[model samples]
Every structure is written in C-alpha cells, then in structure tokens.
Target: MRVALLTEGGYPYLTGEARLWCDRLVRGLEQHEFDVYALSRSERQEARGRVGLPPNVTGVRTAPLWTTDDRTLHGAGPRGGRGRGARRRFLACLAELAEVVCRGTGPGPDSSDPDDMADRFRNALHGLAELARAEGGLVGALRSEAAVRTLERACRAPGAPAAVRAARVPDLLAAAGLMERALRPLSLDWYGDGALGSADLCHATAGGPAALPGLLAQHFAGVPLLVTEYGVRLRAHYLAAGEAGLGAPARALLASFHGRLAAEVYREAALITPGNTHVRRWQERCGAERAKLRTVHPGMAADRFAEIGERGYDGRADASGTLLWVGRVEPAKDLVSLLHAFAEVRAAEPGARLRIVGTAAEGREAEEYLTRCRALAARLFPGPDPADGAHDDGAVSFEEIGGPGVPDLADAYAAGAVVVLSSVVEGFPISLVEAMFCGRATVSTDVGAVVEVIGGTGLVVPPRDPGALAEACVALLRDPARRERLGAAARARALELFTVEQNVAAFRGIYLEIVSHCPVRRDALDEAGEPVPFAHPAEAHVPGRWAASASTAEAAATPSWAGRETDGRDRLKGAAV
Candidate 1:
C-alpha cells in the first residue's frame, strides 16, 4: 500500500517529539511505500537536518510554521489584487468562522445548537481552505486589518460569550495572529494528483495541524484518513494556554478554535488510534466515536536491555540500597518532590541513596529548574568529606546517562534496586517502561497512564506527597523477594505488550483491514482515454488462480448448492447414503 504519513515538528527531523517512533514504524514496515509530509516548527529544527530515511520513503515535502513572509505566501489571491470577488469570499469565510468561535461550542444560552454550530464550523473551515487554494495563500488576508475587524465585530455581537465580548484591540490581534499560523496548512499545495491525492491512505501521526492536511486530502480527494494521537493536541493547547499568560479573550478564542478543529478531525477520520486509554478518553470526550477508537501502545526496542533483564536482580550489595530516576529534567517531572521524598527515604534507611540520571529539557526554564533541584538536594543531604581520599559520593548524586557512573541507559537502571518516577504530570511514563525492560521494581506516583502502565506490577503512591513516595521506596528497598517478584512480572509484561515487533505487527494488520474495508476507487485509462479492463480486480489482492481459471471463475459465480433446494429430506438422504 502507498501511505502518506503526516506529521508536525517530527519524523524525518533528527530532533522532535515522535521522531524515534515514526522512524521505527517506517523502517519496520518497509514493504509499503511512504511519502512524508512534514510541517517544521522552526528554522533551527530544519537546520539540524533529518535522520537517514529508509529506501521505502519515496519523497519528503516540508513547510515552515515559525515564520511567514512574501516568499512563503507567494502573493496569490488577495495579495495580488484578485478583484472584489476574491476579497468578498475571504471576508465571508473569516466572518463565518469567527461567528461560530465567539458563540462558544457547548450548549449554553448564548451558543447556537450543537449540531448547527458543528456544521457552521466545518463549512467555514472548508471555505477558507478553498479560498487558500484559489488564491496563493491566506497569510496576507488573515493578517489584514479587515480580519481583525471581523473578529472584533463577532466578539461584540449580541449573543457572544462573556470572555469573547470583552476582547479589546490587542486581544483580537493576538487571536488573529494565532489563527493565521494554525490555518497555514490550508494553503499547502499537497492535495494534487502526485501528492496526497495519489496515496491509498493518509495516516496523521498527530492531531492539530498535522491532521489538517489529511482532512483536506479527504475533502478534495477521496483519501481515507487514519489519525493517531499519542498526546491529544487539544489537551496540550489547554495546558499551554494557561501557561502562556494570554488575556482571557485570546485564550477563549484559541481554545474554541482548537476544540472545534479536533472534533472535526475525529468526525472525519476512518479510525482513531490513541497511544493509550488516557488519550482514548480525551478523544472520546472531544467527539470521537467510541466505535472508531483503538488503543495502540507505543513501542520500544527491548534488545538494548535484553541482557540485563535476563540477568535479573543479582542482589548486588552496592546497588541494593539505591533508587534511580531517569528522564528529561523538566518542571513537570517534579524532581523537587523526588528530592524531598529521597530525604525521607534516607531517614528511614541510613544507607539508602538516590541517583538522578538525565539531562535537562531544551529550555532556559528547564535549566533553571534543574539548578533549583540541585540546590534543594544539596541542602537536604550534604556531601561526604573529601579528606579521607573519597570521591564526591554524596547521599544524592546527579549524573547524565552517558556520564562515568552510568554510561548507558540499561546500566543506569541496573545500578538501582528500585526505579522512581515522581512526576506530578506524565503522559505514558516511558521511563517506567524502560525500568520494566531492565527488570527493576518501580515506585511511581498516580498520574497520567502510570496506573494503567504499571498494572500493579510496582508500588503506587499519591503524587506530591513525599510521605507516601518515601514509604513506598523504603518498603521496596527493604524487601528483596517482593522486589524480585515484581521486577520479573514487569519484565514479562513489557516483553509481551510493548515490544517493537508487536507494534509493527498491529499496524501491519490495521493497514490491510482499513484498505480492505474502504478500498481506493481509481479508474485506469489508456492513452486514448479509453477505460482499461481488469486494472484492479478482487482476485489481484487474493492468492492463487481464482481469476485465471475459467472453471474456477464459473464456480465462484455462485454457490455450489445454490440451485439445489435443501430440506430435512435432503439431509436424511445424505445421512443414509
């Protein structure tokens, strides 16, 4: 099958969120031809270059979302002075979109009927998409003064929401700018015959902008769309809006836009594959059909930790009292709470130690958070004396994965008797799975997908509570047999459910199932425009000579017993014979 893989800020890029997973999927399914349509987030990410793609990837086309200029916009449509008709179309579509957004999406006194609002949003979105296609792009029009005025008018309309009604000039400007960026995908020339239109299936790696092209493909052509969301983009937008410090009106407008977009994507998809049950629930709440939802867990390579898992816990004396934490050092990881909990663990078991092994996430905020965590650790547990010719062996030590102490990821997990996850917020708890692959007992807080992933294989504690975290750690550290049993069970589960082979096999089957149910309908023609016979027949997909043999073809025309009338007498005669 020919597949069009859609992604945003990932895949093919060397540094991005799901690059590794996308690479694994593409490389594993080498039989299918893949065309990658990626949307880059920034110039630096593009500058970093992409990974070495496999031979099955036929082509790569990219567009930038970071900056918009005349070159990117191509000065088409309104920017080129396409007369009053084009201008009117742009204004009408933008107004229709703004009206739906400002009125709110739910069933409230000020909102339109739910079904009416959904249809309005869908129609307005497609109208803008068509306008972008006719004109070079919508960048110039979306940034125009008229666009801002339209939004302002809608905000002040009679039945607008309270937050939207209070929008001022600056708020309207911000909302317009955001909409312009998000809607940039509508202008891409990827819906042509040689692009997405030629593919048998369009698989969106994530929601939001990544799925926009797929939506357009299904709209313009008749391509079937398969949406996979490891992280729900709408939920992420909600979390980010709170941290963005935008005004109430801008936040409300952006939220409404994303919510509506997600709903439309879900409604139009042939199938929706969420990475876990957590994401599945989010999709269902955002208007995805329960019948269309399927949960496919993320796959990880187990070969790297194979030796360690097979070795199991050897009851090493030096590592028995150690607890390990591994992952990106971000505020969400809640390393501060981990340090505090470790202090309590130290009080309970004087010989217990904690090793934090990971680098900070890519931001000044993460670096500052890492610095604060180090300071907190120092205050809680002072370093040992150096006069005795000892190394910097403190009760708490922080090291990177490739550092001298922990040279590799598997080695890092093997160095601790119990793995610790202290995140107050998490997605799939990848590190916990890594620990499971290494056959180490884990102590994780109750958060996103933790309870689901762990499945009683490890100790669970309430997040943000140092007491519960420390108590769980101490219990695991003190009991060797229980830790061994849980570690063994965790390893067994990981090998069974989260391996790369399983992930690839699941997708391989899904690809065939979707195509079989909704086969692409393309007519074949000769150079003279005459219809070609037997271009794609059912027998082509099936095995053996069912189509080639005249006798077999005739037999397949009808059931063998179709002409014979069957009754109880026939059954009795056959039995007697």
Candidate 2:
C-alpha cells in the first residue's frame, strides 16, 4: 500500500525529538511505499538536513513553519479585504470556533456541551476545508492583521472574562502568529488526486500540527488515517503553554484550538496508537473512542544489553556496589533527592558509591542541576576517596556519554551493580529498560509508565521519597541472588516486548488489520471496462493510467516528489499550492 506519513519537526529531520523511531518504522515497513509530508520547526533544523531515506520512501515534501513564505495574496488590498464568498466562509469558521472556545472556557454544561462542541468543531473544519478549496490556500487570510483584529475583538467583546479583556495589542499579535503557524497544515496542497488521495492509508507519526495534514488527507482524499503518538502532543502543548508565560486567556483560547483539533483527528482516525497507557488516558480524555485505541510501546534494540546481562553478571562491581543513574542530567531527574538517598544508603552500607552518567540535552537546566548535584556530593562525601576511613566523602562520580571521560554507554551500566532512577517525572524510562537489557537489577521511582513497563521485574519506589528510593536500592544491593533473578527476568521482558523487532512486527500487523477492516475505495475503471477498486501500491502503477505515469516518473526523476517539477508527475506531487 502507498502510505502518507505525516510529521512535524521529526522523522526526516537529522535532529529532532522522535526522529529515530519514525525512521525505524518507515524502514521496517518496507512492504508499503511511503510519502513523507514534513513540517520543520526551525531554520537550524532544516539547515541540518534529513536522515538517510530508505528505498520504501517514494517521496518527501517539507514546509517551514519557523519562517513564513513570502507569497502574498493577490485579491486582498493593502487593508486585506476579501470577496463575499470568502468572507462568508471565513466568518462561519471563525464564529463556530469562537462558540466552541466559549463553551469550553469553564462555563458550559458537561453532559450536552461536548456534543455541541463537536458540532462546532465539524463546522469549523468543513468551513476551513471549503475556504482552502475556494482560495487555493488560507495562508494569506490567516496571516492577515485583519484576522488578528477579528480575534482580538471576539476575545474582548461582551461576556469576555476580565483576563481576556486585559489583553494588549502585542498579546493579540503573538496569538495571531501562533494561529497562523497552527493553521499551516490547511495551506498544504497534499490532499488531491495522485498525492495522499492515491495512498492506501495516511499514517501520522505524531499528533498536533503533524496530524493536521493527515486529517486533511482523510478529508479531501478519502484516505484512512492512523495516528501514533509516543508523547501526547496535547499534553506537551499544555505543559509548554504553562511554562511559556502565555496569559490565561490566550492560553485558554489556544488550548481550545488544540482541543478541537485533537477531537477532530480522533474522530476521523481509523485507529489511535499511543506508546504508553499514560498517553492512552490522555487520548481517551480527549474524546477518542475506546474501540479505536491501541497501546504500542516504543521498541529499543536490546541485543547488546542482553548479552552483557546474560554473560557479565559476575563481572559487576564488588565493594559497596555503586548505584548508577543514567539519563539527561536535569532537575526533573531529582538528583538532589538521589544524593540525599545515597547519604542514607552510606550509613547502612559504607562501601556504596553513586555514579551519574549522561549529558543534558536542553538548555541550562541540565548543567545547573549537575552543578547543584556536585555541590551536594561534596558536602556528603567530603574527602578524596570518600569511601576511605578518613571521612564519609559520599562517593559521587559524574560522567557524560560520548565524552572523553566516558566513551561508551554500555560500559556505564556494567560499571555498577544496581541501576537507580530517581526521576520525579518520567515518560518511558529508557535507562531502566537499558538496565533490564544489560541484565542489571533496577530500582526506579514510580512515575509515568514506570510500573507498567517494569511489570514487577524491577523494584519500584515512590517518587520524591528518599527513604523509599534508598530502601529499594539497599534491598537490591544486599541480596545478590535476588538481584540476579530480577535482572534475568527484566532482561527477558525487555527482549520480548521492547526490542525493535517486536515494535516493527506489531505495527506491520496493525497496518494490515486497519487496511483490511476499512478497505480503500476509488472511482476508476478496470480491464473489463467496469468500475473497479484501487487496492495496492502495485495496482496504482498499471499502464495507460495516471498511476502508471507516477511509477514511471518516480523511476526516471530524482526518485522523489520532494521538489518542484513541471512534468505530468508534478500534477500529483504533494506541496502547498
């Protein structure tokens, strides 16, 4: 089958969150041809270029949300006026969105309001669809100062909250910029004839703006949409908005837009695959049907770790078994609490040492947290070789992966007897999985997806509780036989469910199941001169047909529809019109 894989700031990008997993999926599912529609987040990310593309990838089209294109609308005057038909559709969508936003602003009834919200959502979506069809794109209209003025008026009008009424002109401009970016998907021209419409399925790599194009694909092309989210985009939006100093009213308005978009995506999607149960709950809360939801864990390669766990169990550290914590060194990891817990572990077992490995990936948050941890370590383990009899210098060692100090990550896991995760917040806990794969016993704090993923193989502790974390670590440290047993069990579990092989197999089956359940339909003629169905990727390339043209051009051209082409093949290429 031909699949349109939609993504935002990920996949093809050389540096972006979730890029590797997406690349793996496309490469693993080579049975199906893929067309990647990507939205890049930054100029730096676009400049860095893409990861290697596999043979299965027939096309790759990208647009930049970081910087708007210089294209301007021809019909609109300097003051930005539109024709009667354009005005009617624009107001309809805007008004419907406004009503939905108002209803969800903590005032509307819960029982009946969601249905009302759904109606409003469909109206807004259809209205935008019509506008896109009529105007060729919504870019200029959405980016207009007049659109921002309309939003500002609606936000500050009668029944507006005191918070919204207080919004300044600068705040409105910022909100307008955000909306324009959010609506970028509407301007993409990937929803026609031989583009997404030619695909057997539309698979979205993530939600939010990434999935918007998939939604359009389903809308305009009659293609089925499959949405897979490892880290729920709606949750990330809420978290980002909270941290970015967005005013309450602006946040409320923007959140409503995302909420409506998610609801629409969920409603239209044939299936929703969330990486963990934590994300599943978020999808459920956002109006996804239970029948369509599936939980698929992100697969990691575990062979290297499995071999170490099976053969190197006896080679672990002997004295005061060191506790190893590996991940980005950020405040969220709660290394301060890990330090305090190590202090307690020292009182009971004087030979204990704590080794922290992994560099911070983000801003100063990681470096600042590492600095504080070092200072705390100095106070706890005072002298050189703090484990010596001179004074209890709580032995705390810090190292970075790929650095001259620590060349290999696998070595870091093998250096210690117990793997510790003191994070107060976690998603999948890759470190714990790595420990399991390495055949090392683990003691991880109970946080997002920890208990679910560990499944009794590792000792779980309450997050933010130093006593509990210490107790769990001490128990694992004291009993070598039990640690060996748990480590072996954890290794088995990781190999079984968390391997890339398992992940690929699960998605391969899911693709077949979804396509089989809801077969693709297209209005076309067959050999008998009767109306026939279009089913497979090969079937789309029959001679004397448009699909045949696509196949021939695909072979003769640059092997992708990523750039501008004036040939007949360009007629079906996916791009912003």
Candidate 3:
C-alpha cells in the first residue's frame, strides 16, 4: 500500500513531537511505501534538520506553517482581471463561515440533517480550495483589504455575537492574518491527483493543519482519510488563545474557526484514532462519529529499559524507601504539590526520601516555577538527615536529569523503589509509561489519560491534592509485595499495549482491511495496455462506469465510518470562505 503520512510541527524533523515514532512506523512497515507531507512549526525546528530517512519512505515534501515563505507568499496578485470575481466569491463564503462561527449550531459530526452547519462549512471551504487551485494561489487575496472588509461585514451582520461585533481595525487585521495562515493549505499546490490523491490511503498523524491535505485529496480523488491524534489540537488552540497577543475578537474567531474545522474533518474522515480515551472523548464532543473512532496507544520501544525492568523484580534488587519523580520541570507537572505531598510522607515515615529528577522546561514560566518548587522543598525538608553520616542523601533532593550523576533515563527510574507523576495537565504520561516500562510501581496524578494508561497498574490520586497524593505514596511504600505485583503487571501491560510491535501490527492489519474494503474508482493498465486485475483501492465493491445527475453526483464519493458503513455525500456548492 502507498500511504501519504501527513504531519504538523513534527516528524521528519530530527527533534519534535512523534519524530522517532514516525521513523519507527515507516521502518517497521517495510511492506508499504510512504510519502511524508510535513508542516514545520518554526525556523529552529527546521534548522535542526530532517532525520535519516528509512528505505520504505519514497519521498518527502514540507511547507512552513509558522514563518511565511518569501518567494511564494509574496508573489504578484492574480493576473487577467480574476480579482473581482474571486473577491465576490470569497465574501459570500466568509459570510456563511462567520455566521456559523459566531453563532454555533448542530450536534457535531453525528448530525443527520442534509443541509447542516457542516455542509455549509464544507461548501465554503471547498469554494476557497477551488479558487486557490484555479488561480496561481490565494496568498495575495487572503491578505488583501477586500478580505478584511469582508470579515468586517460578517462580524457586523445581524445575529452576530456582541464579541464579534466589537472588532476594531487592529482586531480585523489580526483576524485576517490568522485566517490567511489557517487557510494556507488552500493556497498550497498539493491538491491535485499526483500529490496527496495518488496515495492508497491518506494517514494524518494529527488533526487541524496536517489533515488539510488529506481533506483536499478526499475531495478531489475520493481517497480515504485516517486521522490519528495523540494530542488534541482543538484543546491546544483553546489553551494558546488565552496566552495573549491577539485581540478578543480575533481569538474568538480563531477558536470558532478551529472548532468548526475540527468538526468538518471529523465528519469527512474514514477513521479517527485517538491515542487514549481522554482524547477520544474530546473528539466525540467536537462532533466525531462514534463508529469512526478507534483508540490506538502511542508506540514505544521497550528494549531501552528491558534489562533494568527484568532485574528490578521481587522487591529484592536495589530496593530503597526512595521515591522518584522524573520528567521536564513544568507548571503542568505540579511539582509544588508533590513537594507538599513529600512533606506529608516524611511526617508519616521520617526515613522516606523524595528525589525530583528532571531538567527545567525551556522558558521563563518553567524557570520561575522551578525556583518556587526548590524554595518550597527547602522549607518542607529543612536540611540533610543526621542519620546519613557520610553521603548526605537529603530527605528532599531536586536534581536535573540527563547528566553524569543520573547518566541515563533508566538510571533515574532505577534510583528509586517507586516512580511518581504529579502533573495537573497531561496528555499520555510518557514519564509514567517509562516508569512502568522500567518495572517500577507508580503513583501518578489522575489527569488526562494517566488513569487510562495506568490500567490499575499504579496508584492514582486527584491532582493538586497533597493529602491524597501523600497517602497513596505512603501506602505503596509500606507494602513491598503490592508494589512488586503492580510493577510486574505494569511491565506486562506496557509490553502488550505500548510496544512498537503491537502498534505496527495493528496498523498493518488496518491498512490491509481498508484496502480490501474500499471500491476502485479508477482502473490501472499493464505495460501491454491491458487492464490489470485488482490493481488499486483493493478488490471488493468496484464502481461501475455510470453517469450521475448534477444533484446526486457526489453520493458516490462520500466517506464511510472506517470505510465500514455508508454515509451520504456532502456536496460542495456556494461561495468559498
């Protein structure tokens, strides 16, 4: 099978989210051919450069979603008087989009109404895609005064929210700039049959900008789209919107646009695989069809920690009363609560030690948080214990990870009897998973997918509550047998669900299954000009050569739930937003 793997801000880059996993996936699935389409997040990420490509990956194409590329983005405006018609169409689509974004509607992706909010959204979006494809691009038009004016008109239209109506010139500029960036995929040249459409399957590593090409491919060539989101993009956008820079109206509009876009993608996708149920619920709330949803855990290589995991068993090898917390030092990790919890643990068992092993995050927020945590730790556990006559192993020690002292990740996990996670905000807990992979019992905060990942293998406490967290830690520390059992179970669970072998096998089956199910719309020919049997889109349900009335033409191209059940087409008409 030929898969077009789409990624945003990661993959192919030597360092970024899912970089190694993507390489692993491509290498593991050697039977398939892969063409990577990556969207870079920053100049620094680009500077880090691409990773060594594996043999299975045939080609790579990338575009800058962060900084605008000079040569293409700043080209001359549309030639031969194409401007007036384009502007008029753009305004009409913008009006409908603004109406939907300003005043939300529908029950998400499961809605059965024919002319629902999604259809309106799809029509407007594809109109813009068509405009971009027809002209050289929409780069100039998207940033034009006309676009701004159109947005202004939509904001001030009747029934629009007061927040959107209050948009000033600065707010209008901000909204326009954001829209131009969000709609950048429409201006791209990858919509044709030769690019994304050529693939047997369109596999998006994430949602939002990364899935945009897949949407275009499905629209143009009736290809199936598979979207896998480890981290929810809508949540990221919601969190980012609160951070500042943009005006209130712009933020509101951007959030609405992203929310609606997510809904549209969910509605059109053949399958939606979330890394955990936490993300799955988010997708469900955002309107993803229940049937289309699947849960695929993030794949990890267990071999790195295999030896330590196997050796640290029976509560006999290198057992200590020490508790270890390992991960990047971020506010989300909630180290302050952990420090307070450690204080409680010390009150119960005076000999107990807590070692915070991690580096501070990159930026002032993390630096300040780390500083506060160190001060709190000092206040909680005053000085080195008098029992330690020679090597001063303090009650509470904060040491940066990845140095000569710790040496490696396994060393950090192996240093303590119990691994701790105190995060208030988390996706899949990589540190907790790593701890489990090291065959260590864990105490983690009940946040994000921590509970789902733990699967009764670790003790979980409500986040930000020191009493409960401390109690859980103390309970596990006293019971060595319980800890050993949990540790063994955790290691077994990690091997079963999170390993690379299982991930590759699951996807390999899915690829073959989808290929088997989808109907072949086009036939391929051999070198002798004879029609090849079972050439592409697999063997079952091939479409016959038939003419369709303009009204019902798109019924043939509608995407099904995991390509399993039939769903009617979302015919694209009206102006492009």
Candidate 4:
C-alpha cells in the first residue's frame, strides 16, 4: 500500500529530533510504498536538505513556512487569484475563523466548549479550503487588507474576550499574519485526485501541517488518515507562543486555533498513535477519544550499545562511582540542582566524581547557561588535578566526549556507574533510554516520561530537589548489587520495548490493520490513461490483507469505498472480522 508520510520542521530535515525516528519507521517497513509531504520551518533547514530516503519512498514534496510574500499572488488585474464571489467566500471564512478563535474553544455558549468550537472551526476551515481549491489560491486574499479588517471586526465583536478587545492595530496585524502563515496550506496545490488523495493511507509523522495534508486528504479523497504524534504539536504551539514573542491576544487566538484543529484531526483520524504515554496523555487532554489512541514507542537502534552492554557492570559498581549526566546543556536540564546534588554526593563520598559530558544546545542563552554551570562546578569542586584521567582534569569534569577521543554514545553511558537525568523539563528522556541501552542503572528526575520509562528499573526523584536527588544517587552508589540488577533490567526493558525491531513490528501491525479496514484509493489506469478506480480486486489491492488475520470495527463503520466503487457486496466482502 502507498502511505503519504507527512512532517513539519522534521523528518527528512537533517537536524530535527523526529527525523531519525521517521527514517527508521520508513526504512523498517520497506514492504509499503511511501510518498513524503514535508513542511520546512526555515531556510537553514531547507538548505540542510533531506537525508537519504528508502527506495520504497516514491516521492517527496515540500513547502516553506519561513516566509511568504503576498505580492506573489497579488497585482492581478480584475480577474486575478480569485474572482468577486470567491473573494467574498474567503472573507466570510476568515471572519468566521477569527470570530471562533477570539471567543475561545470550550463548552459553554461562551465558546469554551471544544465540541461546539470544533464545529465552528471545521466549518470555517473547510470553507476556506473550498475557496482555495476553486479559486486557485488564497495567499493574496489571506494577506489582503480585507482579511485584516475581518480580524479587527472579530476582535471588536460584541462577545469578544477582553484580550481580544485589547488588541491594537499592531496586534491585529501580527495575529492576521500569523493566522495567514498557519493557514497557508489551504492554498497549496498538493490536494486533488492525483496527489495526497491517491494514497491508500495518509500517515502524518507529526502534527500541525505535518497532519494538515492528511486532514485534507481525508476531506477531499475519503482516504483514511493515520496520524502519528511523537510530540503533541498543540502543546508545542502553546509553548512557542511565548518563544515567538506573540502578544497575549495573538497567542490566545493561536492556541484556540491549534486546539480546534487538533480536535478536528483527532475526530476525523482513523487512529492516533503517540510515541509515549506522556504524548498520549496530551492527545487525550486535547479531545482525542480514548478509543482512537495507541502508544507506539519511538524506535532506536540497539546494536551500537550492544558491545558496552555485553561487558557491563563487571560485578563491581564501585570504582569510585562516577556520576554521569548527559544531554544538551540548557536551563531546563536543571544543571543548577544537579551541581548542588553532586556537592552533596561529594560530601557523603569524598572520592565520588561527577562528569558532565555534552555540548550546549543552539542559542546564546545556552552558551550563557553553560558558562554559569562551569562557574558553579568550579566553585563546588574546585581545581584541576593531574590524577583526574587522560580525558579529565577536575573533580567535576566538563568534557565533550562527543569528539574523536571518546566517541560513541555507549562510551558516554559506560563512563558512569550511575546515569543521572536532572532535567526539570523533558520529553521521552532520550538520555535515560541511551543509558538503559548501555546497561547502566539510572537516577532520573520525575519529569516528562521519566517515571514511566524507568518502570522500576531505576530510582526516581522529584525535579528541582537537590536533597532528594542526592539521596537517590548516594543510595544507588553505596549499593552495587541493586545497581547491577536495575541496570540489567533496564537493558532488558529497552531491548523489549524500544528497539528498532519492536518499534517496526508494532507499526507494521498497525499499518496492516488500518489498511485492511480501508480500501485502497489509487485508481487503476488503462492504456488511454483513463481512470479505472478500484478495478483491482478489493481484497488483493488492500495492503497487508494477505497476512491480516483479523479486522477492526472501523473497517465496517463507514462504507469502505464511498462516492466511488463500493456497492453493498464489495463493502461486505472487504470487511474482515
């Protein structure tokens, strides 16, 4: 079966967190053909370009979200991008969208009810979508003065929130621009009978525009959508509101817009797969139905860590007990609390050492934070010593083991007797997983999915508490047998749940299940290039049907091939019980 894998700011983009996972998923499932739909967030990311894709990946289509000049679609005489009727429709859609956003999304007639708000959002969204398809584009209209005026009226509308009322002209312009950028997908030529619409299933690797194409594919072609979210895109949008320096009004409206969009996506999707329970919980809280949610852990290759794990522990967790902390150096890593905890660890066990080994993340602030961490480390465990080792020269050694001297993630994990994750904010705790793969016992703060990931395989401490963190470290440090046992268990758990093989197997099953229930959308073509949609055997064309032993209720929930080939016989025959 053909899968349209969708992504935004990631996947194929060389420097994204989700890129590696997407590559693994696509490569692992070589039996299925994939067409990638990617949205780049910056020129730098676009310049970095895509990594090599598998042979099964038939094509890659990309669009920029960085900058869009309105003039490109403007300056058309009387009959330009849209005619008068289409222009009116675009304006009406924009007005309704701005209104729905300002009123907020939730339960009461007050517009806070997500269900009610979702209806309004969907209606407005489809209205704009229809205009884009019919008029050729909405870029010019979306950035026009007409769109700005519609937003102003919405902000001034009778029931508008105080924040909306407080929006000045500058704020209106900012919000309008933000909305236009967010909705740019409506004008893209990626939709229709030939593009995303032809795919058997649209699989979005992330949310937002990554899933937006899937949403459109379902809307336009009746194709089933399987949206896989490693991170909750809506929450990221909310956090990004602050990072982008958007005003309160703009941020609130944008948040509501994303919330309504996510609800509609969850409502329409055939299934929603989250990489972890932490991501799952966020989807659940965002109006995703419990019936539709599935947890699929992101896959990681375990072979690289195999060598270190094979010779792990050595029956002694007591070689001065080096405490290792690894991850991008940022304020959120809570390196401050980690330094304090290490001080306490030093007080208890004088010979105990802490080695912080990782580079700072991108940004001048991360650099500043690293400087502060170094100063704190110097004051806490002062002076460089000759006996520290070839790679080290201080009580608290800050080394870039990512270099040629001590390369490989396994080496970093093996350097420590106890792996420590001190992040105050985290997602999936990749470092903790890496440590597990290296067969090292861990002590991670209670943040993100650390507690869930540990699963009794490691000690957990509350975040931002040096005292609690210190105690956990000391307890594990003083006990070698418990540490070794936890290390072994952690490695076993990682291999079982998070390995490339297990992740591939889970998704392979999910892909088969989704395809089995839904009929393929690709139309069979004759020599004249005439459309012979569904001319292929209903069961034979159905991907994974050959080995699909069981079926889903979702299969029979809707007519498998509506508006096209399925008569009653075909529908019932395609249904697998």
- 1-577 per-residue lDDT for model 2 (tens digits): 7788888888798988788788888888898898888888888898897888999999988877876654422222112355665665575576656656644544443444577568666657655654665455666676676677777777767776554566677666666677668777776666667677787788888887888887766655556789999887887777777877887777777776788788888987889999999889989998999999988899887766665776746644534488888998887889899999999998888888888787645567666766777778878877774223222243777767876545688877777799999998787888998998988889988888899889989988898999998998889889988888888898888888788888999989888776665433565556787875543444333443332332243233221111222232111112442
- Each model's lDDT comes to 0.80, 0.74, 0.76, 0.75
Clashing residue pairs, candidate 4? 105-112, 106-112, 106-113, 106-114, 107-112, 107-113
The local distance difference test score of model 3 is 0.76
Tens digits of lDDT, candidate 3, 323-433: 888888988899889988988998998878887778646779888887788777767766763222211367777666665547687877877888999999999888888
Candidate 4 CA-lDDT value: 0.75
Give TM-scores for every candidate, taking all chains together and pairing residue i with residue i.
0.89, 0.85, 0.88, 0.88
Which residue pairs collide in model 3, if any?
A: 109-287
Candidate 3, poorest ten consecutive residues by summed lDDT: 568-577
Report the number of clashing residue pairs per model.
Answer: 0, 4, 1, 6
Best by TM-score: 1
| Candidate 4 structure, TM-score to reference | 0.88
lDDT: worst 10-residue window of model 1: 568-577
Among these predicted structures, which one has the highest lDDT? Answer: 1
